[model samples]
Target: MKKIKIYLDYKCFPIWIYNDKGELIGNDLPKELADDKQADEVFVKIQNIYDNLFINDLIEFKYIGFSSEIDREGYLKMIDDAVKLLKIKLGDLYVIEEKIEV
Candidate 1:
């Protein structure tokens, strides 16, 4: 299986987007969020959007990007769901994007 790499922008923090192989994917910065709660709301909304898309089997994602606007839990759920769905479709032989530490 092939691996893909996703790089996050410096401005985004906390939430780290990733591809199936654990490569950083995209930045999810919800613009105009008034506060943390609002930010979380936006994340939930985004997740809902993604979830609906996934339910319809419309999205086949090799990578997903998220900005700092998404909290830790939110980011985790998104990544988990993304990978789970991808794996379900691609099977176990799929390769993930990541690096090995020496």
Candidate 2:
């Protein structure tokens, strides 16, 4: 049987805008910002920072799998070695297995 293993990381960022009464506002914020010029300017600056720091920059990894006729123990040892060498935590590791119908 042939199998494949996959690993990935999921990330999320939340943006929040609030009104005077602490009411949450949606994405159409420019209209709301019209009421406060100073706030609007600050908001634009913060938004630019967010775009440059978070939106434009994201972490990613590329891994290539090689096929070998090793036993299950050997496969597991290889995975363990990779995780240790890469300094990856158990919580951040993900694995997907696929069977090749050949």
Candidate 3:
């Protein structure tokens, strides 16, 4: 039997964004948010965006089995298509992968 496995590193974006632009450093924020309370609010909003990412499923699929090799290949093609679509929409923000095993 052959199987396909896919994984999503859902936290990839928040981690990358935080490390790169989380300018909450050294008590220095852009003038617009120099106020500590406002900077904290902006930080909270960014966190909300990160949370929304996990709430939405780009494509929905559970473990589905195929009866024959031909069917398996066809389904795999569909998965490949889905992955491409996701890349277009998500812009490589998530660590995504697919694996086929026999």
Sorting all predicted structures by TM-score, with the top scorer first, yields: 3, 1, 2
TM-score of 2: 0.26
Specify the highest-lDDT model's number. 1
Q: Give the per-residue lDDT of model 2 (tens digit) for 25-80.
A: 43322242346554444434433333333223356433323244454345445444
lDDT, residue 20, candidate 2: 45
* Model 2 regions lying over 4 Å from their true place: 1-25, 28-33, 54-102
Per-residue accuracy of model 1 over 49-77 as CA lDDT, tens digit each:
44432223366433343334455456556
* Candidate 3: regions farther than 4 A off: 1-65
1 or 3: which has the higher lDDT? Answer: 1
State the displacement of the C-alpha of residue 48, model 1, in Å, after optimal TM-score superposition: 13
Predicted candidate 1, C-alpha RMSD: 16.0
**Number of colliding residue pairs in model 2:** 0
After TM-score superposition, what is the CA distance of residue 67 in candidate 3 from its true location, in Å? 2.1
Candidate 3 shows a clash count of 0
Q: Per-residue alpha-carbon lDDT of model 3 for 1-102, expressed as tens digits?
A: 111124223332211121234332232222333455633444344334334434445676333344567855765565456555444544534443454332
TM-score of every candidate relative to the true structure: 0.30, 0.26, 0.35
Off by over 4 Å in 1: 4-70, 97-102
